[model samples]
Target: MNTAINVQGGQYWKSDNAKTWALAIAQLVSWGSAYYSFSLLVVPMEQTMGWSRTSTNAALSVGLLVSGLAAYPVGTLIDRGHGRLVMAGGSILATAMLVLWSQAQDLRMLFVVWAGLGVSMAATLYDPVFAVVTRDFPTSFRTKITLITLVAGFASTVFIPLTQGLVSWFGWRGALIALAACNVLICLPIHLSAIKRDAAESRTEEHKTRIKVEARESTRRALRTPTFWALAVCFTAYYATFAALTFHLVPLMVERKVSAGLILVTMAVIGPAQVAARALWFAVGRGVRPAVVGMVVTIAFPVSVVVLLCAGTSPYLLILFALVYGGANGMMTILRGTIVQDVMWTKGYGAVSGLLSMPSNIAKGIAPISAAAIWAIQRDYMPVEAIVLAVSLMSASAFIVAMRFARSHPGEVRERIANVGANNS
Candidate 1:
């Protein structure tokens, strides 16, 4: 199979750089409108609909859970060369659901809209986009994936303020309608234009047969490995901790008696800090092993949480926490993008990654609501912080274990591929 052929002559953009930029833009819009926009809408929805914050936020949890459930099938589809259709369809659905959510008059309606958005998320969000990059830009996929995250890291920075402005100018409902327009006008076109159609048509039957065998063997091998399960556990716990902190950060700060202005300043630092971290990674950390990066960032999670816990009316400590947390989160995204290729070969990268992401996505979906329940029971953020810190430590430990295991049993798939080539020769 010729990797360069797809880049040179296919339905995708003629240049790899062009395709990368298009997908990066698409990711920014998709994430900004679909996922990050939800948090900004929570207060407005609660105020207008007279629903409790928990009830309103539950809709997002439902959507994320649905997204996690749908991830495997969506990944399988992308593996089958349906990347363009799946992503474009997802954007269209997201647009429709956002419009529906704009007019939601009841909690049930909100749930319905968000439930549909969940499927859209599985199709449009990071997992699907990462799969597309892996499939399309197999040679330079790591750099491309990093570039996408570097841009999309600003999803919250872009949409939080934009959503707030829209709400202030035209109310929450009108703001949602405008977001729907973004999905349709921005995300859908970029996905459709960027993803190449099936490249199997350009390959010989022998090459096609060899690729399929490799993909199947890779998936089978990955499923049977302890490394795969360890990574799953590590990422699941990490995402749960991240989601809980993200959703509850403001409230947690408030409970500590931090003023609203200081809270905003602290929160605003996170986005830029994330972007700066990614830029640094691209400049200096790209040559490092992803497992090394993973272990380092996982440690940062617990340390950042501890800083937040001990901030105690110190704005400097809070800012320091934001920098550490944001930088680690940013680098973690790049690690996730590259780690599968590092630990395993890229034969069935999309499917293998999807399998790994399933539990992680589920954890992300459940973390916020579960953390809220914890806060309700304890009546404070301290216990919640402790819970997150414990999970973060567990996540770090699991990744370290996985890295050691990979070191002892490196290139399992690569060895298999080598043996196959020798037999063929």
Candidate 2:
């Protein structure tokens, strides 16, 4: 086994396996506390604070927007041997932000708090973690990535009920405090201890400059590709639908007259279903083509939404929606990490993935507010549901269009991109 100098002055890659699991666990907690817990808190906050749905949702929207803006800079920091700093600092800041969020006394406070939370997300979430893993573990990264996502897929399953139960015991404010404690106690230690970079990557400044220059040119080439834009559209549309549904699902089910117990159960079904589908895909992923998987995953999105729309008051169909929706959403996570590499070259994945994340993160930021606006129009979620269903279809269509451009010619397109970069250089 190849080894590099550790910070301790003596040793090698002793913590690769530990690093993988620690990052996975941190992602699960970070996402669960910062992201999934928002929906459950919405109604409680609205009832207690007398805030409009739009008003409450706007805070998170702003946070997500900030997250989008912070994505690139965070990636750049990770590129500079700061993975431990970024993730550990993100965990600490997330703890502080969650505490502040619990004490939010006004709209301004909520907005400010969530904006900081967004920055934490940019540092700690899947993209940043993936960057650290890819940088630290060049070989066997796909398996590691798959395992990381597979574990973190249970974020919703575990956090949703745990949050609701917290709310039940001590109200929204208390629940957030509990969450903050969990973030600090669980994530902070793991991030600091587990994320160890190989010292050999600390090359001379000239080597670093050359890599950056090449990465910039590669990004430029990707920008000119029709396939990249289609993926941007596909992912943006997918995220819009995803965010809208995630932030609005509980309320939508309530409006449809679903029981509180049933709502929890259905929502809980999502995480396990997500894990199961991901495990299945992980087993058979290499045998299948990415384009085929992409199409199937995209098609699954609208199908799940249609099921939700048609379920009405039926319990069985609602569970069916959870299964399909959760599975699709899980597979989408894997696709999000892989599709960019499949369609584009992986020479500068962090930079390229951050670029794709910009629009998608913005879509996530806006989707909640957009859904709230639609709900406000008729004071109904049916309209919002219709919008979600439409966007899901739009995402599927965008992927189909993207496949048309690069499906038969991924290798050819990659060669062209490399040649263009070489010529430009």
Candidate 3:
């Protein structure tokens, strides 16, 4: 790893630790204010606006869809060294959208506000941030990515209660306004002050030239490979199951005759479980291969679903399921951030990762409605659970296949470059 400091502009952070911490703070605020706050506001919006639950929720769905659609373009911009502008601009847009949401008097206004929020989500969320980190700390981005997620993982834990308290104190509209203020006051400054264009531009000219050339080849190679598609299938399937189960878990437990108290307990366990799993990995598993980690967590997903399937009203089994599922889901975020770099070369990482994430994000947006449709037909959670389990298994299988391919054919750009040099010689 090159330790020499290459300063492109006077604007970059002097310390990598400072840069990582800044991005981490920005991520926490972004996720908390933009993403997690929606769930808390949904019921309030429905009641206050007199819109049906489905209509209110559809606005969120549209936001998610727009986020998915915007990801590739956002990533392309990041790759072109617009990380600071993208994130800071995103925070500003999100702040405006939140204020818009607070004042929305009709369903049309609600949809329009959320649609803009979706574009902000694409710019401010994990994917674009990951691209920035990968570009900035090319040598040790995995560690930085882990650190960012470790801090950002608390977004839901922090914001859910905070948003609830604000709503209780000042109604939902007031809460939205306060959340908007958080974006403006907290997130915007951190993003603008922390991220510098020189972070990506500071690389040596030779390195930049190499990256440009390899980026094109690596992207072309990746799109042509089975491994890429396999990984995409794995993540898409996993996210679909994850989304469906997440939206339906409480109802599923209720249908199983579990007491409300036990259901809440089970739900509460997930956040801690995720944090614990990530902490454990950071503390002890830093040396472990990401593919190995991927394989284990992918398998854990199915095992967790199976535990829930067989628990049959048993609180102990339900708790067990939550722990396993939550831990896997938590670690999966880290895996998703690092796995592409681990399995393949890092040229064009942002573009490739954006491509990989598009399908999964779309799947996530679709899964809830798809699960609801299944429930509408079956009128029970049994079939839904089974479908989730099946998808989980398929995801695990696809990941295993991708792992094998990665092992067999690693470093596509490196090998291609070596071969071209040899032929010229």
Candidate 4:
């Protein structure tokens, strides 16, 4: 029980718990507003624009590609203590882009607007948020991270039905306009109220106002180790596989002739189960090694993929896949951020994570479209499963390699944690 609340400019900065909840609130607001809203718009947009599913989906793909391009750059900006600025800009852009999307007349126009929204997603979404939390709260970033992701997991469940209702009453265009308004009116204000520009600078100055052994080691030596690259490889595969599978999940189900209603029900189980699994991880993960946690989540990829590939349309297997895959994927999001911090502190997070994330984001951007292309070529789901399986195997292998590297690296992770302590102290 640690309770030392310090007031800075009339705001509380002392309690890690408070900061955790605040950041988590921000994550929920940002991700829920952006990512969750996409699925809802997909169906209605297809219906209204009289567009083919591929074209409608192409707009989203374009958005994701823009987002992927934006992730690392946004991460670099966040590292510069301009996270609040980036997030605010993202919210504003997202709000404006939603309005633009409402008025799109053709696929080209829709793709163009979504391309803008992609940039917004990069700035406001999890990558930036992950960078923010890791920088500001060093020691407890993991548990807080887990909590934030757990909350954001509910975005689909909460937003999907709400969006459907809104589109029902107001029509898709009107609903999109209303959603744009909410992004501006709700999300924009929250960011402005909660985040202040000087916060990052003040922390940076405080940490660097003096130098110590840990600081010297973090700055001078950590980069030379193999651990960092190993960790990066692990995370890249994690994101690539997870992103690919998630984007293709629904279509994969339909290809298997799984009924839409059952798919919905099974998919619905994921959010709550994700929360529960994360909570469990938070409680027990502290007792285990970071490598262990990473491996558990990483192996879960193959488990879920294998189940889906082998089990056909069985509801039980699908539900099982949802729980294991969703829980592990949700847990892994936090795991990636924390593992970096656990192994390296906040010193090189932006650059290292950003570099590692670039390729993965590209993979994510291409995953759905690539999966679709594969499906088209094969005229079935078998080839798509092959791709997912290969990706999963690569991820699992990376995790195994990372674990071995961590064990051999000895004091690498502890040294990074010590660097954070030396700064705050």
Report the lDDT tens digits of candidate 3 across residue range 1-425: 21223355434456778778878878888899978998898888777778898888788888888888888778766766678899989999999999998899999999999899989999998898898888777778889989898888898899999999999999999999999999999888777766766534346687566655655666678899888889999999999999999988998888888999999999999998998988888898889988889989999999999999999888899999999999999999999999887777565777788888888888888899899999989799889989999999999999999988887776664575355445324
Model 4, span 269-350: residue lDDT tens: 8787777777787777666777778778888888888988876878898898888888887787777767766655577465
Off by over 4 Å in 2: 1-15, 40-53, 164-177, 198-203, 259-261, 413-425
- Which regions in candidate 1 have their CA more than 4 angstroms from the true location? 1-11, 200-217, 411-413, 416-425
lDDT digits (tens) for residues 168-287 of candidate 2: 999999999999998999998778777764366456687578667766766786798888899999999999999889878998999999999899889778888889988988788856
lDDT of 1 by residue, 246-292 (tens): 98999888888999999999999999999999998878888887877
Q: Which ten residues in a row have the lowest lDDT in candidate 3?
A: 1-10
Alpha carbon lDDT at 374, candidate 4: 81
Tell me which residue pairs clash in candidate 4. none
The superposed Cα distance between candidate 3 and the true structure at residue 9, in angstroms, equals 9.5
Show the colliding residue pairs in model 2.
none
lDDT measured at residue 169 in model 1 versus the true structure, 0 to 100: 97
lDDT of 1: 0.85
Question: Model 2 misses residue 6 by how many Å?
Answer: 6.5
My TM-score estimates for the predictions, one after another, are 0.92, 0.87, 0.92, 0.87
> Candidate 1: lDDT of 52?
93
Candidate 4 positional error at 224, Å: 5.7
Residue 405, model 2, lDDT: 90
lDDT of each: 0.85, 0.84, 0.85, 0.72
